[model samples]
Target: MPIKASTGAAYARVEGIGAAIPSRVVDNHEMTQFIETSDEWIQQRTGIVERRWAAEDETVESLSLEAARNALAHAGVEASDIDAVIVSTVSHLIQTPSLAAIVAAKLGTDGAAAFDIAAACAGFSYGLAQADSLVRSGAARRVLVIGAETLSRITDTSDRATAFLFADGAGAAVVGPSDVPSMGPVVWGSDGDQAHVINMNRTWPEAVESGLPSQLTMQGQAVFRWATGFIADAARRTLDAAGLAPEELDLFVPHQANNRITDSMLRHLKLPDTVTVGRTIRHFGNNSAASIPIALDAMIASGEAKSGDTCLIIGFGAGLVYAGQVITIP
Candidate 1:
C-alpha cells in the first residue's frame, strides 16, 4: 500500500483587509514640544503632519483583536474558519507567550495554530509570505496575518531624531484558498553588516540592570541611502517577478517610514503616473509593521484602491531587512 499524502490549494489570495488606527492624534506642534523642531521643518523633511498614538485604554492585544475581527467580517469568514494566525510586531512586550495565540483565542478561532514574527517593519509582508506558503502546502486552509505596533511606548521622547517618527496602530489581512495566482513571489533579505542602521539603544538585560528603558535609534542618512538605492531596485524586481509591467501596476504601498524615501524610490522605479502611491505617512507617521496594511485598508475605503487592482507593496527597517511582493487588492 502507498502512503497517504495531503494536498493543499493551488494558490492563495488575500480575502480581506482591515485596520485599527489609534484615536489620539499627535500633531507636529505637539511633537515640537518634545523635540527642537518646527511644524514646517517636520513636514518638509518627513511629510508628517501628525500621527496617532494609542489611548490609555488601548493595548496591542486590543488593537490586534479589533483589526482581526474587522478582517474576518470583511472576508465574510467565520472565526472558526481560520486555521492559523500570524502576528507580526516588535511591540508585543512579552518574552514567552505569543501575541498571535492570545489574538486567536479572542477572535473565537477553533484552536488555530498561532505564532509571532519579529521582523520589525518588514513583518507584515514576511507574515504574508508564510501564510501564502502554509496555505499552498496544506499546512493551513485560512490564515490571518496581523501587524500591530505601539512604538509610542518605547519612543525616546527627548530624542530629537526619532521622537516624531513613531506611532501606534494595527492592520490585518485574511489569506484563503484561491484557484488563481493572486500573490507574487516575495523578494526579501537582510544585511547584518548594516544591522546597526536601525535598532535599540540598549539590550533588555542592560536596561534592567541600569533601571532604564531601551529606545529605538537609527542612522538616518544610512537608512535613506539603503532604502532609496537597494530597496528601490528590490521593488522593481518584485514587480518583475510577478510578470507585471510598470504600466500594469495600479498602486504602490511602500513602508511609511519617510515621504522623502518614498519619493526617492518612485524616482528610481520610474513607475507610471497612473499608479496611486500611498501617502498615509502624512497622517499616520510610521507605525512599523502596521503601515503597509493600514495604508491598503485606507486606500480601499477612500476609493483610491479598488478590488482586483494590482499593487506592489514593500517594507524595510531594523535588522536592515527588506521584503516586497505584488498582490491583488482584496
Candidate 2:
C-alpha cells in the first residue's frame, strides 16, 4: 500500500549519492569482434555507443561496497549510523545471503536490518519507496539503498538482441529522515502476462537439464512496444501523486533501458524544454536496477541538476514490473 503524505511527520530525503561502474569499456565497434552487429546497427536501434563490463575480480558485492562507501562519504554518515540496508539487483551471482546482507557486512553495519529486492529495473525505485515508509513510520532513521548489477556475466554475447544492451555497474543513495519533504509517493505495479517479452529463456534447473548457459534472452520489439505504449501514463500518474504538473519538473530520470524509449516518453509526457532528460544509456547501456541512481548521480555531478530541483524518476523492466516517483535533488 502507498503511504499517505503527511505534513506533520518526518520524511525521507536523499542525503548522499554515489555510483561505481566497471573499468573496462566495450564500444560498439569492439563488440563486432565477437558479434556480427556493427556500431551503426546498435546506435540506430538503442542509442548506445559503449558500455562497461566488470573485470574478472569485480563482483556485485565489490561494486556495491564501493558505491555504499562513496554514498556514506557524501552523506557524511558513518556505517554504524545506518538502520537498514536494501539492495536491488537481478544479476547477483549467488542467490543466497542476499546482496544487502553481504553489503552490510562489508560496510560494518552490524545488526542493521538488511535485505534485497528483485523488481528488475524498477528495483531501486521500489527500494526508495520502502525506505521512505520505514523512515516516515519511525521504523528506521536511515536506510542505505543500493542498486548493483553485473548483467554482462549473464549476457550471451552472441545473442544480437541483448548483447549490446546489458552492462555492469552500481549506484547508491543514502535515505534519511529530513525536516522538509523530498521524496514523493510511489506509483508502481506489474503485468505478469507480458513477462515472456523479456526474460531468461530457462530457469536454473532447466538450464542444467538442457546443458545451456543461464543467459538473458529478450524480445526487443515486444519490449519497445510495451514500454512506449504504457510508461508515459505511469509517469504522469507519478507526477500527479506529488501534486506537480509535468512542466514543473526539472529533471526526468527514466530507466536507461533505451534511448528510443526515453525519447518516446518525453514526447508523450510533453515535457517542456526546461526539463533536463537523463541520457545515461548512450554510455552506460542499461544497468537495470542501477540505471536510475547512476543517471541521478551523473546529473548531479555534471551540474545538469542541483539542490532543490524537482526530478521525476521511472523504472520498468522484466516481470513487466515498473515504479516511478517524484523527488527533490539533494
* lDDT for each candidate structure: 0.94, 0.91
lDDT by residue (tens digit), candidate 2, 1-330: 999753323778898988998888999999998689999999988899999989999988899998889888988999999989999999986889898987898899967999999999999999999989888888888899999999998899988788899999999999998888898899999999998887887888998999997888888888898889888789988999999998899999999999999999999898999999999999999999999988998999999989889999999999999999998898
Which 10-residue window in model 2 sums to the lowest lDDT?
A: 4-13
Kindly report which residue pairs in candidate 2 clash with one another.
none
Q: Model 1 TM-score? A: 0.98
Model 1 spans with C-alpha error above 4 angstroms? 1-3
> How well does each candidate superpose onto the true structure, as a TM-score?
0.98, 0.96
lDDT of 1 by residue, 190-298 (tens): 9999988888889999999999998888888999899989999999999999999899999999999999999998988888899999999999999999999999999
Top candidate when judged by TM-score against the true structure: 1
Q: Which candidate gets the maximum lDDT versus the true structure?
A: 1
Model 2 clashing-pair count: 0
